[model samples]
Target: MTVRRPAAALASLAVTALALTACGTDQQAAPGEDKIKVVASTSVWASVVQAVGGDGVEVEPIIKDPSADPHSYESSPQDAAKVTDADLVVLNGGGYDEFMTQILGSSGQGKPTVEAVEDEHEGEPAAHEEHGEPAGHDHAVNEHVWYDLPVVQQVADQVATELGELRPAEAAQFNQSADRFEQEVSGLQGRVGEIAAANQGKQVIVTEPVAHYLVEAAKLQDITPPSFVNAIEAETDPSAAAVAEVQNVVNARQIVAVIYNPQTESPVTRNVRAAAEQNRIPVVEMTETLPTDKTYVQWMDAQITALQSALSQNR
Candidate 1:
């Protein structure tokens, strides 16, 4: 995807770079500031940090707007300053939020950073290759790893470990909080398992693969044309044949539901949604970040619930 950094954003970044040079390498909290300052790429990861850190850390998400697309997000000087000042930084990584990666790279502060994708699969090969799929298609290593509950659990544990190292006095508390968060994640996983048991192999379609991992967890088959998914992710129009194939699938009601990502909606996707609605096929909404006033667990739980409801209603 093309990321256009505005001139103002570049100027802000330059100012932040200068400020960091003046401040030197000190990344500690200010006097009397007890909370560990945590900066996350989006509210999804921020919610995870908040759950594990509890009262011990003050978390800030750079992309808090629900409608904002992380792929094309423009970073400002304040965002860079946040990364420079943060004791710990959390990111989804895997090229999903290149803006955060850019800020972290430019900050040069060497703060403790936890990336959900890279850190979760530290020793494993590239996920798409491991699955024996091409890089950018249906079976690719989806960077939206937040939809993968097991990965989320691993990330939470890492967050606790990182926080423990920062404030050794509260190490045990952080671990305990992560333990509790894991239990909740386990509960969410169980729900996904239930969906799998009830509707394994059920066919569905998506505008983009934002919930690829979640759909996989439930053993649902995403019949979205690979070309269509690739084009949507690349922010380009799919070939005429690809678009026609997807429309045919929807018109025929061949899929159980249409998994739609409204955040990345386009005219083509909108037309697909309209076709699904007209055919009375369910359209389940998923997003890249947390919805308003929701914790990570709450957000995933709600999506899983919606998926189950969609399947049952179609049945």
Candidate 2:
């Protein structure tokens, strides 16, 4: 795997032997004074954890930088320390946050972990009925479960369940918060369903699979060439033939919009965006991580609203 993405490279922290008196006691909370310590791999998961934990838990997300690519996240000693102090850990899993695994292992903390991808609910209907294959399903599985609204809802429940295990006393509060979040997010999901219903069978081009879940949720057809998107997701350069295939799709003007990932940039993504512009197709940029300025629901609502606006123009 020679995949590479832009990252703030971090220096590996070396552990040195210290005198027994020099090392103070671990900072982890003693068996329940109330606040549960949580360590999340990314901001998206962190936001969900925070929503569920409410005032009962303190969440520390390792990759909170909005400008950073979660795929390219680099771990540091500070992140490991956070994990060491956590009562529970939440990660995207499915190979998306492999760095978190390394950090946890180094920390030697056997904290209970919750993996969102592993618990993803299945058998979702394809947004675009015209496309024979199920929406969000392909030869290559997209590990971006956060973009899948239903999956996010399911993961919210999972988080509450895991967090509740750590603090049985506040379990009811955690469940209540998750239920509220689900209800609120359902309103957003309803909006997406309505938009998809209005523009059924519409097609789109994506630079990567970051927004595939949302694209499917909106019931839009993704016409992006698999070779091109697969290469981008793999962080490898697509062959000239693969790039040309994407160019042909853009030239054909068959797609209504281009879903671009501004966080992960490459020559291929840039070329696709350039081609979309030349062909007069609207390009909407989406991110994998939650924005620093907005909550998860707000971030998702904004993206769907932008897509609706852009797609409406094409119609």
> TM-score of each candidate?
0.86, 0.82
lDDT of 1 by residue, 139-229 (tens): 3357888887877887788787777666766778889999999999999999999999999999999999999888888999888888898
lDDT tens digits, residue span 224-292, model 2? 667777778778997899788788988999889999998878987898899899988999989988888
Stretch of 10 with least lDDT, candidate 2: 1-10
Candidate 1: C-alpha lDDT: 0.79
Off by over 4 Å in 1: 1-33, 119-140
Q: What do the candidate models score in CA lDDT, each in turn?
A: 0.79, 0.73
Model 2 segments beyond 4 Å from truth? 1-34, 119-140
Task: For candidate 1, list the clashing residue pairs, or say none.
Answer: none
